[model samples]
Target: MLHCPRKTARTLVYSGIFLATGLAQAFALDPTGDWRVADGVANIRVAECNGSMWGAVAWEKQPGGRDTHNPDVSKQNRPTLGMPILIDMRKKPGVDQWEGQVYNAKDGQFYSSTIKPLSPDQMEIQGCVLGFLCGGETWTRVAGPIPSSPANSMAKGPPKSPGAPPHTAGMTAPKTTGSVGPKTPGQKLATAAHPADPVGDICLLPDIAGFAH
Candidate 1:
């Protein structure tokens, strides 16, 4: 029997996985790409940032839509395109579904939500208001399965110093709703008539960069 160090053995296992799958991005929430909403009105870009999952509006067929219904008067003029629709979704332990909050721009409400991938190109998003009036829709994958970003990463940074405390969130995450998001902090939000920049990495957006754990 050949003897191998623990680290070496782990590397061998991961190498085997890469060799077998061509890539190891098949992990459940690897749904980090663009998805077309059921209504076909918009595309949401989902990605994992800071160990949690989040999504934002990447495109809107109608182009100029506002969060007019948003209770936050400050954000009422912000464009719906490129807005963060999915908030702080953390994976449920031992389950494939993720639990978090979803912003319903139509009603300007924050509803409890869960997201699960049904297939390589399909994902299910369920949203509920106050635990009732539950409803869901299947979104068709349009772009990703892409690589995660490092901006708000938890494990990709420099090694912690000896005896250093573990990384912790310096500030609480933005409120589930009534907080400006999907918009870069400090930068003036665009009007509803603004066009979407579907190609951009939303994880770099202010709300996301500041919220990651």
Candidate 2:
């Protein structure tokens, strides 16, 4: 009968995992790339910097060519381009979302932000002011590389397709005006836009809409 040492078995198991994880990480698709913020106010480009990954804001789409948010701060004399806005938060098991922080160039404020991977090409960024004081907005993915300059972005024309038909908002269809029909999905249940399941309240229906509720 042949007997393997306990320590040797443990070492072999851990070594296998370590090697597999190292290979996985090496081949993992990195999200570090060019991304444009909502409204094109900021264009962020991520690349390897200082032996670590960092992002730099290449161009800012200034409406009036002025930084009204932080006028005192040197818009030009900044140490880094985009600055250290977001940090790698976590990569939890069974979860695909990547958590991070978002630094507001306006008041120099940092907020808890998250980048949810919608698909291979699309991601949603949720950023707020503080403790729900300010509302959060979603950012859609833009095609191609982030514009180098505001002029270049403008020259490309509107963000939407040029030949696309004009959008008509707030146009509602004629109501039947007869009887109150059955409630649809939206009316049937409520869901939290941003939910933090601490205790794990697994409800059948989406009853709680707000985080607190």
Candidate 3:
């Protein structure tokens, strides 16, 4: 069979590009898991929402916290436990970063955020507002099964407090909330020994009526 050299070269180039794109997609970092944040005082569950990614406060050191600092007067009364703090993160093409907005309940402000996975068990999370000033934390993956239901989580109650008894089934705790600041020198990111697992429905949060845009 007669063959054209120029056509063969073009075909080879196209094949290479196709393979490269496929490889990038195949090895993309999957951030669908529970991550320990705020110096291990809080656990935020990252999951897929509406083709994008979002994170919600799955568990806090203190339960029954409210979004007292939220700028919106009405939303201030909302509980922070299930609040969607990491909002609408879209994966950046050909990279291990995701760009989105991060809402800080402590300051009641939304900042531009980017999440980059440094390893399967660790990721760098950054939030910036003034363009130049940026703060970040290295979040480590949390292992084991996350509470499957609100009832189950409440049953387990907040992490044990010295001299405090476990909360009753129906009783709620006092609200206590704090801000997540930049990691300081010598600050260690929390780590877990269990293997990473898909968050599944355990971390899914209710859809915010108008949050997605």
Question: Highest lDDT among the candidates is held by which one?
Answer: 1
Ranking of predictions according to lDDT: 1, 3, 2
What is the model-wide C-alpha lDDT for candidate 2?
Answer: 0.39
The alpha-carbon deviation from the true structure for residue 190 of candidate 1, after best TM-score superposition, in angstroms, is 24
Which residues of candidate 3, in runs, are more than 4 Å off? 1-28, 144-204, 207-213
Candidate 3: residue 17 lDDT (0-100): 100
Judge candidate 3 at residue 74 and give its lDDT: 84
Better of 1 and 3 by TM-score: 1
lDDT of 1 by residue, 94-148 (tens): 7668899999999898999999988767899999988899999999876654453
Error of 1 at 164 (Å): 30
Clashes of each: 1, 2, 0
Structure candidate 3, residue pairs in collision: none
Off by over 4 Å in 1: 1-29, 150-199
Candidate 3: tens digits of C-alpha lDDT, residues 100-205: 9999887999999999877756778999996768999998776322221222222223532222122334434322111121222212232232123222232223
Cα-based TM-score, every candidate: 0.67, 0.40, 0.59
Candidate 2 to truth, TM: 0.40
Ranking by TM-score: 1, 3, 2
